[model samples]
Target: MSTILFHEIVYGPVHSRRLGISLGINLLPYDGKLCSFDCIYCECGFNKDFRTNTHLPERENIKAALEDKLQSLRKENAKLDVITFAGNGEPTLHPKFAEIIEDTLFLRNLYYPTVKISVLSNGMHLTKTKVFDALKKVDEPILKLDSAFDATVRIIDRPNSPQYSVSKQVELYKKFNGNFILQTMFLRGEFEGNKIDNTTEKEVSAWLELVREMNPREVMIYTIDRQTPTKQLKKVPLEDLKKIAERVKQLGIKTNVAG
Candidate 1:
């Protein structure tokens, strides 16, 4: 069995393909995971195992701890690349998320001024003004749009609500007007007898159309980099990812692929 990677308040300055060495902040609990979507590719496992009513870190405590950590890293002469808001679940779901962002900004200025702040969000909460405003403060708000079709989204992402529509989600993304980094995970396979293939021509066509409409600043085309909840899921090869990247580049859209 694979042990959960991020079940704590702070994780690694782990090697990240895009963010370089990143210091992770996990606002969620160290045992259970709490997320709006139960993605098949989530490394922390599904929202079922450790998912339940739980307590997240208080905003002030998070700030103090982060400040202390940053100061310690500085003393050790350890280089900090990015302070990422990612871990077990959706970081934005914290009630004081906005205040947390403000505190992070202040601490970054005081200690790691050169470090960038990035949040890996599911884009489910982007429709909220508070979430949007708070995320706007970050250096990069990389939002997820795993698929363009509502049915495919429901199947793959398995969001909390049945009424959730991918089209509406993309529309909310468009409201950002290309201010965000759009992250996509490309793959093909089956999960529980349902055929899952997001790399098909039809799927790619729809995704590209959505991209054209959103006009994002950049797109991160990555694949499964960790263990997943579903065993039957497949990974997209790096060479094929490069081909997709090539097509994205042709559209004059910046893209980075990590397979």
Candidate 2:
């Protein structure tokens, strides 16, 4: 199984197709994966295969590490567009997630006021009060919604909670009040002998309906950009992704396609 893991608390100012020049903050363990959803296409690979023996970085450690990196970058005058919260898993899962966000905000203002703060989440913990509030504070709360149907979500995201449903996710997203950004990964192939393709007319139509309801500030539509854990999966062509983006644009919501 191919995987890419961040083995540090604060990692690269890597060029992100969606978020731009981003300095990553890995709130999860430095050794393995920790996520609510075991996505087949996750570049970090499946959770079980990358069980972590390490602990989540303490709030103080994260703050210290981020400040140190920022100070160093400032001295060098490095170009950084955003500080992104994403790692092996769900960042909101951190116990002091809200406090950490506050620390990050302060540091961002002190170091790079113009730089944005983004959180790339699976939206599994949005119902949590702290997580919701923390996400609200960020510039881009990029939450994932790979499918509009519960069945399709289960197959693609494979959320840990058996009760996780698209309906619940939609309601949680509604709480954002059009303040969040909806991100969807479009792909097709077989998984465990089951054929999967979320770009179908039926799927996209249902997704567009939900998009209309959520009315997010923006929609990020993209296909697999990195090697996925599931070899059977295939990337949706750029033309198809642009077609989807056009549908989102028709909804009057800004759409960013990373193909």
Candidate 3:
């Protein structure tokens, strides 16, 4: 398996393809990953490794461990650009997600005061009041929106709820408005026997429509940069990514490419 699994609350200082040198906080289990969306391109594998009965670390424990780690790193004058909430599954799924975010804020202020806190969420829980509120507290809440079409989203993200529709997701994004950074993983390939492509002219047009409606602070355009769990997926080239970013920019939306 991959060493992305951290035994405790804190891990990394690892190079984040998008966020630079990041210190990760995995609120999920150390032994496995847990996320609301079973994305075909998930780099940490899948949720089969997750044991639901296993308990997540308590808030006090998280605070203590994170403070200890950050304090130690501060003493060493370590370089860290972001404290990211990322792991095997979804970090927002933790029961004390709000408390943990608060604690992380407290620690981030004390030690790396300039370092931003980011959450790489699937946006499945954005409908929940608590989840949405907790996400609001983070510095950069980068939510995933792989597609605007219901069928395409289902094929790509494989969201658990049958009722989780693109319309509902768009409704949720309306609430975030400028507070959120919309991230779409632009790529094309085959999964199972179905042909998949989210970077085509049709797909890009739909995405740009949403970007214009949401008016997000920025749009992060990128393709697969690692070995994904699925074998048939193909990466979108850098030129293609830049082209998509340029289209998004034409709509007056700021764009960043991590291809």
Candidate 4:
């Protein structure tokens, strides 16, 4: 039942496995989770378990808080590799997500001109014009696509939308024109009474076909790195992750594996 939640609007310059030294921005409520997907493996636990009563952070408050943190960091001359949009839940769910990205870009340029801005999204809000364009503005729009099949996605990501499909996600990713980073969480285990594994030959081959079609700038393949809500889940080993990355590499796509 253990979980992790960010209780601040602007927090962390934590070492991230993928993004390096990162400053996190939590646009969701500080007290609970508000995500578009209720993934079984989510570290924040289930959305129903952490029902939020607090409002999403205001754009103005986010701007002010972020600017203040950047200003302080600048004064201290801290090494920040990236400003990441990730928190208890989906960042693009914020009403003024686009404006907040604009604000973040301005502040980033003002404070850490070279530091990159990255958004770790579930790819649920890409259909929203503002969210799509806002994601395009960042240096890295790391979008998730855990499975090539809708059924597997339903079991893994448990997206709130019944309309979510791998084909639709691929179409949206195609719009990026190979500019986005595709992130997939590879894991094996059972959820509820069903056996789940995205690493099997069938799953990986189908996923690879989509990956080839999207032709994203890079693919990040990794496994569970922390305690997940579902106790049945198990991490994919580094050697196995490397093997997957090799498959991606063979397709002439840049890949990164984090075990």
Candidate 5:
């Protein structure tokens, strides 16, 4: 099992295979991963291992740290392609998430106006109007939707919300009016005692139908790239990902593959 975690509030201008020169903004926890979903393929390990209701950084502190980093990057004349709001876990879980978004946008404009701002979220908070509005303000709202089937989602994402449903989330996504990007993780694995594979015809067909409905700007189809907490999982091949991309493109939607 991978116990990978980010240890800072603002870390990295790391090179990303999909999004180049990405600077990461950690809004979860400095010492652990806190997410709404305990995904089997998460590099940050299981959610229960580091679950907590305390030690969340204040909005002022996060803003200060982010501005400090941005100032240094500006001094160095660093080339940053995107400021990604993603770390060990979900970013919107922060209590002051909307405020943080505002602060981040202000800093980005002040220090690097041309650079894009992105948020990598699980989309669980879209029902929260503040979070939804905040997402609408970002340059890239990369929302996750791994499977259209609730049964497969339970095994793959393990969403903490008991009332979570694929149909409900699809409706929430529709509200974005094609401004969002759909991120889906493709993998084959066995968790506990059940076989989990989200590449079947039914899974792809149902997911594509929802994708057509949402009509997002783009679809990111990627496979596991690191060690997962669940040892039984296997990464889907790049060829398969390309195939999925082709199917997605058939709907007149652009697709990007990351693995």
Candidate 6:
């Protein structure tokens, strides 16, 4: 059981390889994971195994905890870059997601006006108007789009709903009006009896074509950096990641690769 659950509502002004000096907001419960996508490469293990709290954290409580952190950071004059909504699961799944984003932006102005507010989401909740509206407000609305092929998406992401389709996801991305950052997690592994790998030529080709369609602000490409729930999963090599990045660049899309 390789678990990396965030056990606090307000955690780390930790250094991020891609986003600098981020203070993470874990909207999910302290002990459990609740995400729409059960990614084989998720840092936090699978859903049922690690979940502890059924009730989502209260809006007031999250604000209080965040304010406390922001105030402390302000007192120290800390170099904060972004306030990211990413934790045990999909932050947008929180019922009061839009309200929280509103609170976060207000707080951002009061404490660190220049710092960006970001949300790390699986894009499953985009159909919901409120969730989509809130996501558009963030500086970095980072949405996951690991693969363009529906079958590969089903295998790699294991979306909770059987109805999950890549074409629909691309449409949701279109709603953003080329204003969002697209993130992809490239990996190779086996789940149950099936062989899983998204770094292949076929996978990348499909993905590249779709990335071109989205015409996002930028494309983030990365490999597994921590132990995944699935022990058999393997990280896509940096060289191979860069190769994919080069192809993405050829599409005239800026690509960011992280190990």
Strongest candidate by lDDT:
2
lDDT of each: 0.86, 0.95, 0.85, 0.94, 0.91, 0.91
Scanning candidate 3 in windows of ten residues, the lowest lDDT window is 1-10
Order the candidates by lDDT, highest first.
Answer: 2, 4, 5, 6, 1, 3
- Where model 5 places Cα greater than 4 Å from the true spot, the runs are 52-54
Instruction: Write the residue-wise lDDT of candidate 2 on 91-186 in tens digits.
Output: 989999999999999999999999999999999998789999999999999999999999999899999999899988999999999999999999
**TM-score for candidate 6, residues paired by index:** 0.98
lDDT of 5 by residue, 116-204 (tens): 99999999999889999999999999999999999999999999999999999999999999999999999997999989889989888
What are the C-alpha RMSDs, in order, of all predicted structures? 1.2, 0.6, 1.6, 0.7, 1.1, 1.0
Model 3 ranges with Cα > 4 A deviation: 1-4, 49-52
- Candidate 6 local lDDT, residue 137: 92
Clashes within 3 Å, all models in order:
1, 0, 1, 0, 0, 1
Output the better candidate (1/5) by lDDT: 5
Q: Write the per-residue lDDT of candidate 4 for residues 1-259, one digit (tens) a residue.
A: 6469999999989999998999999999888999989998899999999997898888999999999999999999999999999999999999899999999999999999999999999988889999999999999999999999999999999999888888998999999999999999999999989999999999999999999999999999999998998899999999999998999999999998999
Error of 2 at 155 (Å): 0.7
lDDT of 3 by residue, 104-178 (tens): 998999999999999999888887788899888888999889988989988888988888998788788789867
Candidate 6's C-alpha runs over 4 A off are none
Candidate 1: tens digits of C-alpha lDDT, residues 158-235? 899776898888888888878999999887778878899898888888888888889888999998877777788888
Model 2, backbone clash pairs (residues 3+ apart or across chains), number:
0
Tell me each candidate's TM-score: 0.96, 0.99, 0.95, 0.99, 0.97, 0.98
Q: Candidate 2: where is the Cα deviation over 4 Å?
A: none
